[model samples]
Target: MWNHTEVTKKLSIKFPIIQAGMAGGITTPELVAAVSNAGGLGMLGAGYMTPEQLESDIQKIIKLTSKPFGVNLFVPENPVVIQEEIERANQLLEPIRQRLGIKKKSHLPQINTSVFDEQIQIVLKYEVPVCSFTFGIPPRETIHQLKKNGIVTIGTATTVKEAIMNEEAGMDMVVVQGSEAGGHRGSFAEPFDDSMIGTMALIPQVADHVSIPIIAAGGIMDGRGVFAALILGAEAVQMGTAFVTCVESGANELHKKAILNGTEEQTVITSAFSGKPARGLKNEFIVKMKEHEDSLPAYPIQNMLTQDIRSEAAKQKKSEWMSLWCGQNPRLSKHLHAAELIEMITNQIEEIINKFHLIKETERLI
Candidate 1:
């Protein structure tokens, strides 16, 4: 039997499941709306979009579903770029660029101006029901403003200390992203390497430490994983890899095929594609960039530099060159509609619960 929890009640969602906001153009309005319409909380990945794009997508999602949805923003990082490091990375990339038939000087791509404040303004203008953030905690003033506008706030954390920090900052809930999760690690308080806590270990510890509801995220691809997370004290499970195979997913055909055919052992946590460490399928691009990993420029810089190459690769359907971000268990991802996927997961959880009850009853009879 499904049970309503603090997360479900607070979010006004029928199910205690949230489709992970897999940013970088992967979380399209269609996917978000489908998930919301299916009774799960769907979130728009606003982390990579311009304020204008975010506003348009927000409006689109609203048009499609009356259910409450959330937007996730990346906490900006303005790291000082060591010119020498960038230069070395460029030299390392020159050979690959030549291999890909591109001849260009090693120079940083101009970054699009960050519209964080404007994006926040858009969220408030729409009265978006929820806002979640990763990479780092939002400024207290920002949090305060959102709360004043009646937006339910969530913060992503990679450690127990970070969860406590989120609670202290007055967030409505916390998403504890474990080490096995795809995409970027949400570690900000310390070096990310040291913060690699797994879901099984992290959820219970975070639950014990924070007063707010805990949402578990990582290698959770099925209902069994959701059942396990709830038992470990999570109020809900946030899944990204599983949703990548959904019919409404924004992943390319190659991305979907690669994910379905891939395995946990095929993934590696690398900063080659983007300057920050994110888990993705190991391809020739990732393999060649390994040597220059330490010298790559910080995010937004290296990420911008490689944008054209990635785009061209995608145009050519070169999976090897695509980011292909995925969690540990890619094989478990199913190709289903978002609504159908939710129903399948719900049934799986119900079956698990029923089996447990039957086992207990039989034990009592004995």
Candidate 2:
């Protein structure tokens, strides 16, 4: 069975599938519990949540299922430098804000301090089984604390160098996130442009060099992807886009619909929605914001500025204004229950392995 792999045994899951911790309410307790109950490691996206909110959500997940689940946090960076360029970027957004009938406000909202410290405390207090971090690896002291408390640590990497750093930092595993991943690019050591390694290419290389297990991510939409990743030396596969359409996912209806109707060409990597480069189904906001791309503020800041518009768009069911994140082959996604999808993917991988064995046996006699 697929659970015989090192990752499955280590994570105590029946399959090597990990539901990605896609933040901004997509990775709800319902979805996480559903995936965990289905034998895959469901991850809770705890980056945007406050310490109190995270504790409440974790308690809810415990009530829902006894299975182990992971929580992902965004590693905070140095303080963002404020400049007049941010003002210029706001000037650019004026037109679209007007179109949405949003009233102009006097002062810009205060930049939020990263809640990484507070969130991690909650994880340790609650004894979360696994914890993953994006944007960058956690400090050695933090990693030590988590490991001391019996938590499995995972760090996201976009390049082989980043993976090496993770291994050096004592990460239990590394999530090798390919460029085709939706939402945010987890690259931290280098610029986003230099870290566009695809899943197939990135996995084997990271696998070749790192002693720790590699969790392959990005553009993996089906069982074939899961099988391929394993063959490339990945211990498991992490999927986000595939689960977005699942009934248990917390993605808004319009966001789900946009993904369901989208073409591969419809999605583009843009920093418009958030300051960091992220892929999403392209819309009016992306197109209009392109001219001002040079002036946009850094992440958390840019993300804050656009929050109101995105919320209003979701409320109005306007696809053009909502952020619909998905992978390169989102059209391949199916509308199914979380358990049903997990079962289907498991079957496909099993069948593929069987067919491979049959082919190898036939070839030996030739």
Candidate 3:
């Protein structure tokens, strides 16, 4: 079997793997605690959450496991750079507003990035052991504070340039999220379309460029995939879609079923959910939204418009109307508790490594 090294140990995790903090409340305390209790790092997705909500979740996670779990923050990165998108979203949502039982059009909520300071304070107050960010490099002062407080920091990177920038920016590690990863694309580089590199190519390339350890995230699911990533020089592996389907996960039943039922081709990257690109199963909502691509507003605005509709759709088991995120190797998703799943994966990794050794021994005799 392949020798497991220190990833969580360096990061203070019991396992080398970390569960990606899927946003929009998909990452729950139980889900995180289960993983942490099982040895892997479980991260609370605090992207859209308010400070109070974030605190409550942190408390809940603490209740579940005293072992270290991380929290993911979405750094402010909006590409729209236009105020017209707000008006555009209202007009586009005119029909949705009518059906949502609202009589008059209401202006979109204040679009502001004022929450970062407050969010950071809460993390510091709680003294969280690990905090990771997406979108771009977090402030150097904040990075210094985290390091000073003995907190391990992680930055998500989609390209070599981003990885190098992260290393320079003083991040402790970089999550090399390939294009095939579920949910949002952590593209901090120009020309987002060109940032779609797969894990097999991106991991080694990023590892080679940066002196920091790389966490392979994207299509990794089973033990064979984990072993493959370790052999590629990845210090650890992070799996998002696979854990999203776990019994302990907070994903709605429809969303969970959608992930477990999905095939590689069933998923596609679309900005229909939010103005930003994310990978989800192609459904009626996406196909219909494609017809009005020009009218779609920028993120947060587009994200808010579909919020209620997505919620209602989930209650009705309408997976087509919701964002169903999954990775390319989603077929590896299994129906098991988070802890049991980890045990199974470890066993599989051992078996795969043993088979390789057996092959090598036979070849030597020949």
Candidate 4:
């Protein structure tokens, strides 16, 4: 069957569809368990979770389902803390903060370089079936440790060079995130702008260069996308925006409604929210900060700086100020149960296969 592939065999899942482990509460235990229970690999977006929170969620997911699931982590990046940049970024954000009634300036964030190690230990302790990383590949020793424990390791890449780097570092699979993908850009080896290859182009080129399995992401929302990814040499596809609208997703109702009502032209890639370039709905926060993006603090710093504004915006039901992350194919999004979405995808694939067979028989008769 088309669903059975190297990814399915390696991950021990029934289908090659892997739910993107979106961070910031989108991948709730209930959502993860539901997808895994339905035969797709469900993942917990544990990028921002504390070690304690990770362990608790793992326990909760275990109670919800016996099927395999995965956790996605942000491979730590320690950028130099530039005090001037923080003050400048804050100066730009002050107006929005005041509008949201956020009185206190967000404290200078303490960068914890040890969080990744602690997270690795939690995965090891629980023997989580799969562990994936974004931002960049983890240390070789970390990959070796996961493999030694019989846990599968996956990495994200935006360019073919990055994909090869993941394979060289011993990753079992690499998710080739196209520029159209939602959330953060995973380009590490070069500038993200130069690595913005679309899904159709990136998948085949990376497949030729890397021996490990490839998981195609970005702008893929249905079985048609899954079918095309397989044809392009990807063994599976990872979907994030598709799942963000699922009934069980932990995304705020406003976020979900925005995506459902959004058009393809509405999404834009901006670093205004997290200091990392991510695609999402263009809004007041993004537009107002466009001029200041070049000076913003890197990643965790800017991400920490904006925490209060985002949280307050969500609480106040202000979608314009929130980080409304979405892919390029928002028009294809549907509000369905996770299981129903999976089922619809599988059924759609089956219909396409049948139509292809019918065409072949017609050609034979002619």
Candidate 5:
């Protein structure tokens, strides 16, 4: 009964658990299908994928499973490009690139303003079951178009005001990403630093403000976190760090190892890798860039400049220069099959419920 909620009915999934759609190759087709087949919703992190790449992955997922899956896209941002800033960021990263033996310089990033639109068309063409947006809410027309096609639209938010914006835009559900969330901060309405509310506090506040279903994300790693979110007024939970170490995850081995071996105090939020603030293990690159983070070009720009360093570092087995994105609850991470992870969480939830019921029965007898 705990797993049965509005999210389950609307998403048409057996369990209320949804794997966080982590971009940068973490949510592979196999992982997505495995999660969906295991009774929870699996999502493809298509934010960084090309339109063609998105279509190809969708086809692959279709062959792997008939169960419903979701695709997450990053809402396009139009930051003012500063050539001077780009040069400075590149200058700061040159030493790392040299250390990794990367000979070629990274070119200026090309901003694809129409990529989101093209991705939407792909989703419509394939009739994907669910589409979620991060960084910001999509246009009202975009939400309307997705809803018109019967595709569930979920928006990410870090504050109550952002949740209300998603509802006004007609989002079917809103994922309130707490400050404890890994990867990029989905705080679009205000400065991310001011929007860093924890999952426990953000869920109930957003629930009180918005009538749409709330999917709590951030520091949610197991059944205890899931049950806690539901009790905090969330209809469901989205987990990222818990899935990053799964066997099916496409994350780099070193990245997985860093998280597995990482402690709760090791992770920090930095915008050096990408023009946006994200939580990950503090490494040499992060430390070197800390002083210059505020001066770097806005995301996608800064993200482009550091691409070579991250890629080469991974190839050379140097995690010190790589981005090991993780949440505050890294100690709870486990390496297992996606299905096994789902089953474990489910069993844990069931045991917790049974224990509570036993307690209630004993109290009644007394």
Candidate 6:
């Protein structure tokens, strides 16, 4: 019989282990399929792809696994979308442009949730079971539409206040993203900074306040992290850095090798790559970003300026300039199949449960 937590029973997932959505190159169809088929929930990262590309990937994932999976989208915060950052970032990159062998962006760039309504519409049309949003919450209507189709909604938050807002916006669940998380910081207000709360502090408080289900994320790696989160009231745990090392992931060889070769001390938060604070591996680009934080444009501008550089770095195996996102617990990673990885976690969680019971039994005997 399947021992399902409330989350597992609700979603029909076997375990409460959810593969965190790593946008861009990490969360591929192969990775998502392997995870969901193995009895955990998997979410497809659709942040950087075109809608058609997203459709293709979703189809591929479905073909690979009959089990239910999900998709994640990034919601840009209000005010500036993509252009302000692009134009500003291009100007900032004038000096590096000469050396990078790329001409300056000739046209004035403008970016806003491109085909935003259409993408949400597609999510409904396809009847994807679960959809997650980050950076900011989607419009009220967007949330209502997804709910109407019975899509499970999750929002990411780095702080408790943001998690409250997610609940108010009617999210089915909220991912409590700690400071130690990789890739982008999911802060929705003010700016990203180390509020300094670890996963332990962040998870429980968010759980206490929100009526919706809470999913814990950050530096969680093994059974201990899973055990801790469950005790703290998280219905499930969302993990990213650990999955990046899995054989089923789409992370480049260099990227996977970097994670395998990393340490707790190797990770640092820098705004150089995207103009938003994010945890990643230490490299030359990261160093420069820290040194020139004041010089960079805001957000997507900084993100756009470095996009091509990151692309080239991936192609050439230049780990120094790439946005090699990672978490604090990366040193403990195992290079294994996605299915086997979840199984390892299951063994650990079961051991913890059994030991607790044994201790209780001894107490009764005494």
User: Each candidate: what lDDT?
Assistant: 0.88, 0.88, 0.82, 0.93, 0.92, 0.81
Q: What's the residue-level lDDT of 51 in candidate 4?
A: 94
The candidate 4 region of ten consecutive residues with least summed lDDT is 357-366
Q: Residue by residue across 54-125, what tens digits does model 6's lDDT show?
A: 888888887998888888888863344455555555665665545556565455345556756656777887
TM-score of 2: 0.95
Tell how far residue 203 is off in model 4, in angstroms: 0.6
Residue ranges of candidate 2 with Cα displaced over 4 Å: 112-114, 357-366
Model 6: weakest 10-residue lDDT segment is: 77-86
RMSD in Å for all candidates: 2.9, 2.9, 3.3, 2.6, 2.4, 3.3
**Candidate 4 lDDT over residue span 6-49, tens digit each:** 99999999989999999999999999999999999999999999
* Candidate 1: residue 55 lDDT (0-100): 94
TM-score of each: 0.95, 0.95, 0.92, 0.97, 0.97, 0.91
Q: Write the per-residue lDDT of candidate 5 for residues 1-366, one digit (tens) a residue.
A: 677799999999999899999999999999999999999999999999999999999999999999999999999998999989888787888888888889868568689879999999999999999999999988899999999999999999999999999999999999998999888868999988899898888999999999999999999999899999999999999999999999999999999999999899999999999999999999998899999988999988888888888988999999999999999999999999999999999888878988786444445678
Total clashes in model 4, counting residue pairs 3 or more apart in sequence or in different chains: 0
Better of 2 and 3 by TM-score: 2
Using TM-score as the yardstick, the better of models 4 and 6 is 4
lDDT of 1 by residue, 1-366 (tens): 244888999999999889988887778899999999999999999988889899999999999999999999988878787788777777776776676776685557555545777889999999999999988888899999999999999999999999999999999999999999988878989888988999999999999999999999999988899889999999988999999889998888788888899998999999988799999888999998898788799996788778767877888787788898889999898899999999998888878978876443445677
Predicted structure 1: lDDT: 0.88
Q: Write the per-residue lDDT of candidate 2 for residues 121-213, one digit (tens) a residue.
A: 999999999999999988899999999999999999999999999999999999999988988979999889999998889999998899998
Better of 4 and 6 by lDDT: 4
